[model samples]
Target: MVVESGGNARAGRPRAASAAQILEVAAQIADDDGLEAVSFRAIADRLGTSPMSVHRTTGGIDALRRELVAALVGDAIKAIDWPTGWREMCRTFAYALRDLLMRHPLVLEAHRQSALEAPGADDIAHRVVRALRDAGLCAEEAAYAYATLHDFVTGHVSIRLGRGDFESTTAPAERRGASVFVDHHDYDRRFETGISLLMSGIGATLAPRIRS
Candidate 1:
């Protein structure tokens, strides 16, 4: 997505370097290629400027990668019309996050490389935990539920993108042992099933404590 750059540029000069513009180009490169393909030179080439210009505007590649993660997360979170009911809220959050990761699978790779915290991650976590609390989970349970849900969505998307441990090694015969097993093609159905099971498990295992 082309993020509109802010500020004006003088005639005959490249537009003033905006982080959003750099990230927009960078994201496209990462999506077309992979996260490793994103480089100062690549972004510069797209922006009609030198790599040094891109570096100066974004601090460095590491910083830029971190910013990219935060931007992607923040943008996706903002777009979600989060539901009020706890179960629906968790479902909505899961689907929204999964969709974002599918679109930009590189976000997970960038997140891994950065290792430093992304800015908006905490806010996203808080929203998830709040939903759990509304579901009658205690503070600790809410936190655990939030983490579990987040991991499930990200892990599901990662596997769908062929980043799973058995993606390359599972023998075809082994894969055929069970219907829907090792099958990445029908991810929507698989994901829905997984989420439904998780929601049910959470309600059955934890919601009762609150109701009791």
Candidate 2:
């Protein structure tokens, strides 16, 4: 049965499919091929429907792109089931977002020109702010910390994933030279160290003000 734009199918009409479902299919198209492949006509072809049918539900390509970004961010947030503490939660959330972006590299490109005021973005930002405040950071400190953590995680993941270097290719002697001073270590340790360094810097900067 065909889905209508309003979410509910009219009497005698096919059952209405959710925007989420449409976005999911669109996301698959984007993820598998790239965001450029996520046109209304493409989605319609994937769904075995006419381009007009998809356009009627999604409004247009721009609307579909917006919905796709929202869906991806929402999915990333949902995947983060961290522990109670603010630091732990932030770490988990950061890693989860990194993983999601790495898995869906197209999302990184899609959000390049988009504002961060989207629904899921706002919710994630609020959560980060709340977590930082709970960790004894002031609003300004929390904002800075959030930005720093996001930049580090996103930048690291983008580099790693974009280079397609999850698997090492160098020999043992070459691998040892990869680290200038320290010995070769697991990637997870490197990630944790980066997160810890950021958290420590934030704590140090805010401690004086917070204690005053």
Candidate 3:
């Protein structure tokens, strides 16, 4: 059945396509080719349907891209159990986001676009902001912290992936009498140190202000 995004059912509804099916095909196209390769026509071709069918199901490429982001974010969210300490929650969440991006590298571009429009993306942002607010940050401070943390995590992943040096650059093996350090271990240690420094600074800055 032809399922248009508007949900308009004419006298002959045809078979309405499922949004999930459309998104899955679009994601496959994006992964196999790239985000630019994802179009209604491209997805339809991959799914053995006409472009109109995909457009009816997903609205357009923009809408389809946003759905892809939602799907990816949903997967990431499922990896974590929330309602814990805000700091720990956020740290784990950031790691989860990193893992998600790495798994679906092409989806990163869609994620960037979706972050500006998708309600699910905004929900994630709001969660981060709320966590900061709960940690004694004022509204403005919480907003700033959320933005900073988001940028930091996404930017770090971008660099790692862009450079194609996620392993060697992040943790190069020592030559000669090289110290006993592995890439993954180094990455974890440095990542934890950076998080600690940021949280420590935030705590110090807010302590006096909150007391005052």
Which candidate's lDDT is highest?
A: 1
Greater-lDDT candidate between 2 and 3: 2
- RMSD per prediction, one decimal? 5.2, 6.0, 6.9
Off by over 4 Å in 3: 1-18, 111-114, 166-189, 207-212
**What are the per-residue Cα lDDT tens digits for candidate 1 across 1-212?**
55443234223465555777899888898887887788998887677666888899999897887777778877887788876778888898889878888888778776556542655667767888987787777899899988888889878877777745454355566655553554464567879998999899888876567778
Error of 2 at 38 (Å): 0.8
- Candidate of highest TM-score: 1
Worst 10 residues of 2 by lDDT: 1-10
**For model 3, how does the per-residue alpha-carbon lDDT over 1-212 read when each residue is reduced to its tens digit?**
33233323333443445777777766777777778888877765555566788787777777787678667667666656666656776776677777777777775776565444444567777887888788788899888887777777777767766766544545444541264434243555655677777777777877887688
Q: Pull out the clashing pairs in model 1.
A: none
| Clash tally for model 3 | 6
By the TM-score metric, which is better: model 1 or model 3? 1
lDDT of 1: 0.77
Question: 198 in model 2: Cα distance from truth in Å?
Answer: 1.3
For model 2, residues 76-133, the per-residue Cα lDDT tens digits are 7776675786778788878887787788877787756565334567777778888888
Q: Give the deviation of candidate 2 from the true structure as CA RMSD.
A: 6.0
